[model samples]
Target: MTQNIGDALENSTSQASLAHSRKISEKIEQAIKEDATQFRVLTGDRPTGNLHIGHYFGSLQNRLRLQEAGVDTWVLVADYQVITDRDGVGPIKDRVYSLVTDYLALGIDPKRSTIFAHSQVPALNQLMLPFLSLVTDAELRRNPTVKSELEATDGRPMSGLMLTYPVHQAADILFCKANLVPVGKDQLPHLEQARVITDRFDARYGRPKGSDKRVFPRPQGLLSNAEMVLGLDGTKMSKSKGNTIELRMSADETAKLIKKAVTDSDRHISFDPVNRPEVANLLTLISLCTGQPQVEIADEIGDGGGGTLKKMLTEALNEHLAPFRARRAELEANPGYIVEVLHEGIARANAQADATLAEVRSAMNMVY
Candidate 1:
């Protein structure tokens, strides 16, 4: 009788676990459907150089997904935020246009998604004034992304703009009244700071105690499932590190880079990121491109060694990126098209930003 009770208890626990998992899965499906049909998504990049596959897997692909879902998408070319650490802006105009061209080549429709230069949006900058006042210095100093960036600059003196760029980000989001900010885990802290500022601003100058409407909706982070794409050297893919596969690289260049990528000497192929990060990173990259499981990729390669893996990766990447390169080449031919896209995006962005800024000023009684 005691044995029967034990078996019954175990069965009950298993059933409960399965039920819970089903509930969670249902919620996730619902969220994905909702995101596809309705949401305001804000996501962008700082154009320091040509974007790598890391940028694509990390954010750009997700942006395209949402845009296709009919979600209101806004992509910012954060030009103003680029000078926080660097001294002189090197060919910033070319970089900005390159970034826009890449966006167009990747299927980010200028009509469906508003893509604009951050520096050109005056209302976004104006919104920063009050937002700056809402956060404390200590809070700025504590931002993890800021700390990592400062460290990357190797103990350089912290610039004021660098410290308060999180506030600038808040303005970027709120100026467009963004309710969903797609981000990686590393960026959660920045979005959290944005939320804190939004709450404080709403309390200070939002609708009266009895009113229902509020000025700014506290934005939430839509955390990405994608992992941090490692560079050829098994570190972060960085332009400075010279270990990135740029999105626009030709097939030969990509093949050369993959050939030179660091990998282990072990004859066996396996996905062990901790022990064989180089090999595992390659497999991860392949999986991302091919939509195949890493285990399957490893099994297929099966003791063919790193050389076999690199060859496979090279072919996969070149094949995958061919369309993107062709599209970008076409866009490059008509440089005026890139300029026109930016101008149209800027006009649309300014109109939306101005409307939001007017509401903000009125709420703060700055409408004299």
Candidate 2:
């Protein structure tokens, strides 16, 4: 059971907090608009499993927006991070290829964005050593997201890698000095830790005596406006649960999944998320897909029972995902092309990461 990054933030959310996040998002957008080249976005998932609808709506869409806006995008497969909680690494390269296809299917242009596997960048991982020294064990233990994930591990002994996840995440963002990260509220703490590391490291060394610039810019969290998309069972969509509508699923497979969705017996459906979450979850999906409000969709499907609701959702979802599916099919067939994409991305990442590492070494007076 993979725990979400922000299980602790559930209790901390409020209108005021959301408003603050939105304000920050607006500031970043304006900054990017003024000078897109001055900003870079670091976003991608660990090669855990097939990315589901939850990923698409939650994070993928925002990354696309940033790329389309001409911001430099660095997408990391985070291959090493997969070993954090598990004894087995599983088929990481395969997962990375799947994730890349999902990205391509969903509009991640390799030409416009650099996508690379974590293990391919040695200089990037090397950052972990100095970064580890910058933070205390107490500080690492204090991260709320880390705490939640530890609990999610179901009492398995926490590995050192797991404990240092936030630091590793910091390496991902700072290795290339990405100034903006697409994150939800739960990940704010993770981003904050990266900022902390950047601040401390910059103050300690590496800015070049009078270059008038810090070694690394403290990256900001680009808070998302996406909603929490529930799975068929009215719970958070997760790959482990087999409740997700994965981007790679066939149209028929998607329809079958929706058909099995748990909806209430109430023939008269309304968008009452707090009361009838299962049906409301279906409404939410339809709304996200069709760009129509949940209430309106519920009204249209009123008294039609769960069957009609599922049917509507099936059509809307499939129609919305057809292009992505078509592109994914072609990409899946062209395995060689995917390798080329990964190779190009890895080469680009190597140059960027090597430069960053050189600066870090020089700053710490360890440039032997």
Candidate 3:
């Protein structure tokens, strides 16, 4: 009887686990759908260099999906933010336009999405002056992303702009009255700051018809399902590190980069990230591109050795990226069309920013 009871309990536990997994999946799909309604969404790249596949799967894909779902999307070319982490802006001056070209290459249709240079929207930054005082230095210090960035500088004193990047991000979101900000878990703190500042402003100024005031909707961070993709070297895939595969690269270039990627000395192709980070990382990259689950991919590649794994991964990545590469080439062939799209996106984004700024100014009693 005791053995029978144990079997029953095990079966019950297994069923419960299956139910929980299904529930979580449903919740995620529901959240994505829920967040897609009557919403203004803001997302962008820092434009440090050409974006890699990591950028596409991590954030850009989600942005594209949101736009397709009819969410009002704004893609910011974060030119100023790049200067926060780097020493010079010479390459950026040249590369920013390329970023827009790549955006056009991707499926970010300017007809539906707003794409613009961050610096051009001066009115957005104007809100930062009043919003800055609402948050604390300790709060900024506590932001994980901020700490990681500052630590990378070996404790070098940061610029005022660098220190207040979170606040600037807040202004970017609230300036468009964006209710949905798609971010990874790492960026949650900055979104929290946006919420805090919005609440503080509304509380201080928002009254009634004949009374006080309120303006911005405290934007929520619609967390991304995507995980942070590490580079070939098992570090963050960054252009400066020379570890990235640019989205605009040819199939030959993609294969070369993958072939050279670091993997374990062992011959076996197993997916044990904790024990073998290099092989596991490669496996994850392939899985991401192919939409296959990590475990299933590991099983299929089953002890095939590094050479075999690399070849398979190379094929998978190229196959997945070929369409985008072709599109990018076609788009690059016509610089005029790219320019028109960017200008049109800027006009739309500026209109939204201007309207939101007006509401903010009115709420703050800055204007009679």
Candidate 4:
């Protein structure tokens, strides 16, 4: 089987990471075949804004699959992380609840998946202390996520939280011993750091060599199957850029947005992301909605022009999202249920985190 396994590990372009990605990709397949119940997955979203199609295609869809496969899945609403790079955390409480609503509406069954708020889980955050000690300041600066976030902030001095954002994420994963983290190519580095932290702690503090007491599982990045989901303007889909379609937008709102999506003057629709990115993005969105091959969709819309392509997308996408909208409306009507779900998740997360922390302390001989 020829594998461009290189792409799955696009976490790093180096030969080593490519080789490692191939091995993990195969392990992921085997893990699904084995007793999946033995594996736990930790995935999350920072409640910065409403989730967009990029999120759906990028990670959430895979999350739903993992949930259905009977794997233990936990979705963290990283409420505190929202303040990492930003100055003022905007309507965070609302966004956090809205995130839970989106998850429920999108079929993330709380009964199966533990959906928790980071701020509500104290024990989990407690793991950050020992984790912080395990990582060096030089290592923190070397993190690509830290560098990228720093670059995003125009020369402003970064906060201590921002400097150690990656370790916080490592804490998120290790606190629960989550072995699989669904991530995009851009997030591979963050997952790598979590693995590094788990290994470091295990080495320095874990039980003896012959009878090693592994307190944390080295998490692996389960690469998303979707390509880089672009915005209507053919740029990275971003809420800040206003180029995204939020998951909660009504059908009419979605149609209005798609109507304004960028496209070329060519009447013939085709999938050529290289030279005709805008047209290709529209086609890709349509394919994602209808689950048809992009080339086939483009051929089906040949010579129909951008208007016809957008029309098809608006229709397909609205139909696809209609059920989610209905579900969300019902969930919105009962805000209590949303809070109940979050509270339950926090309880479960606290239990797991406390257990891990207790064991970690014992391993490090810090129980005293």
Candidate 1 accuracy as TM-score? 0.89
lDDT of each: 0.83, 0.87, 0.77, 0.85
Residue pair clashes in candidate 4: none
Clashes of each: 0, 0, 6, 0
Per-residue CA lDDT of candidate 1, range 1-368, in tens? 11222232234235564454345435644676866545688889888999999888888888888788788899999999889887877899999999999999999999899999889999889988888878767667767767677788775687889988888998888888888887654565676677777777877887533447777887766756677789999998888999989999999999999999999889789999889998999999999889999989999999899999999999888888899999999999999999999999999999999988878877888787
Q: Per-residue CA lDDT of candidate 4, range 1-368, in tens?
A: 12221232244646677567767867886878787797899998999999989999888998999899888999999988988877898888899999999999999998999999878888889888988887777667767777777788787988999998988998888888898888766677777777777777776776633445588877877767677778988888999999999999999999999999999899998899999999988888888888899999989988999999999999999999999999999999999999999999999999998887788778888776
Regions of model 4 farther than 4 Å from truth:
1-16, 208-211
Candidate that would win on lDDT: 2
Would you give me the overall lDDT of model 2? 0.87
Compose the digit string of candidate 3's lDDT tens values, residues 131-161.
Answer: 8867667666656667677888785887778
Off by over 4 Å in 1: 1-29, 35-37, 149-155, 208-212
- Looking at candidate 2, what is the lDDT of residue 190? 81
Give the better candidate number (1 or 4) by lDDT: 4
lDDT of each residue in 1-368, candidate 2, tens digit only: 11222332332355666677779889988988898898899998989999999999898988898899999999999989999888888987788999998998899999999999979999999999999988877667768867777788787778899899999999999999898899887787788778778877876775754467777897878898898888889887888998999888999999989989999878998999899999888999899999999999988887898999999999999999999999999998999999999999999999999999888887888766
**Regarding lDDT, does 2 or 4 come out ahead?**
2
Clashing pairs in 3: 205-213, 206-213, 206-214, 207-212, 207-213, 208-212
